[model samples]
Target: MTPEIAAEADLVLTATRAHRADVVSLQPKALKYTFALADFAHLVDGIDEVPPAQTGFFGPADDSFIGRLVDHIGKRRTAIHPIAEDDADIVDPYRRPPEVFAQMAVHIDAVTPPVVRALTLE
Candidate 1:
């Protein structure tokens, strides 16, 4: 992605850690907001529901839930650890065998619930 695109983004979610790094390299300023999908899901687990005002989403409400959510997740970055390295990133299943693709699906399944729950928390 271009630096401009990254700069304009509220959050960047990639399939893998390497992809997240690639985006970060293009926009170092986005490091705090960029994350692998699985990694972000893991971070979301540490967040406790807070009022909009607490997360800067109150009053006139100029901020989005995602923007505030990202801030909360970013704070938990050091607090959560994946049970395994695989938990932090889903394998790129492009041009792979059915078995490999299934593995990727499993990894996605593992993170999907928490991620979805967090997104719908509003």
Candidate 2:
């Protein structure tokens, strides 16, 4: 990933720990915002939900809600960091069989809800 892209990102998500490492290597500054998809879900298990917020009355709703969520995860990183680093990895199905791809899908599906809760309004 380009440094510029990483710089502009509000968050960086990867499917696996290795991919997350690559992103962090390229843009160390994003260490706070970068996360493996499942890893982030796992790490945030302890963080309380952040209710969706409305923007200023005069302005349009924007990405600030998401930014606030990302910030909370960053703030709690150390306390919950290592809990799932190894177990949270989603298997890569890049060149595997149909069954393997399906397995990967299941894995993703299982982990998606928590990530959604962590990042989305609904």
Candidate 3:
């Protein structure tokens, strides 16, 4: 079920050339990643607890450990400033606003999925 779920999700994500490129670039060495289903499930439960750092929409919470995780994973900080209302670079036709991608990365880094911490290609 997990594989199926993940596969379906990936299929939806990699359907287009541009999206495929973005996904591939976000995390190139993603095959080595192996996320624990149990941990992911637990993460899902507390997922909403993690806040956004920028737009008040899933931004990082003050004094949270996610920042440390991002550092541990060696995730370079990239500012999302100048994000326009209809910014193509930040918009995902496959899902909600593209800003959510950054938000998810925070969660993935903090949780450090045993299978794949940095699935993003770039």
Candidate 4:
């Protein structure tokens, strides 16, 4: 995405690690908002109070749930980085066997709740 588009976004969630370089490269200012999907999942997992999945949509509020979550994650960012870097990518399951797909699904499943929770937090 272009820097303008990235700037407009409240958050940028990449599907995989492969996509992160492109997202972060041209848009240095977006670094705080952009996150690899799995990396974000990992970051949100340890937080004690991730807003529940019913706060509201991303915008139109005084402060969005995602904005709050991002702020919280930013505060704990240094601690979150080292542990997440190595395994922050979800495995690509394209053109793979059912077993491989299942493994990929499992990883996605593990991360989904935290992401949902963060987005939904009030």
TM-score of each: 0.82, 0.76, 0.21, 0.74
What root-mean-square deviation over C-alphas does model 1 reach? 3.6
lDDT of 4 at 24: 76
Worst 10 residues of 3 by lDDT: 74-83
Across 1-122, the per-residue lDDT of candidate 2 in tens digits comes to 88888878988889888988898888887787888888787766645676454465756443476666776666567666464555667877888899989988998898788787666553
Best-fitting candidate, scored by lDDT: 1
Q: Model 2: runs farther than 4 Å from truth? A: 46-48, 51-63, 81-86
Name the regions of candidate 1 deviating beyond 4 angstroms.
Answer: 46-62
What tens digits encode model 3's per-residue C-alpha lDDT throughout 1-122?
24444333322222223543444455543222222322222223322233333333556432334433332222211322222222212223456776777765554454445323322211
Off by over 4 Å in 4: 48-62, 84-86
If ranked by lDDT, best first, what sequence of candidates would result?
1, 2, 4, 3
For model 4 the TM-score comes to 0.74
The best candidate in terms of TM-score: 1
Query: Per TM-score, what order, best first?
Result: 1, 2, 4, 3
What's the residue-level lDDT of 41 in candidate 2? 78
Lowest summed lDDT across 10 adjacent residues in model 4 is found at 53-62
Taken over the whole model, the C-alpha lDDT of each candidate is: 0.79, 0.75, 0.34, 0.73
Using TM-score as the yardstick, the better of models 3 and 4 is 4
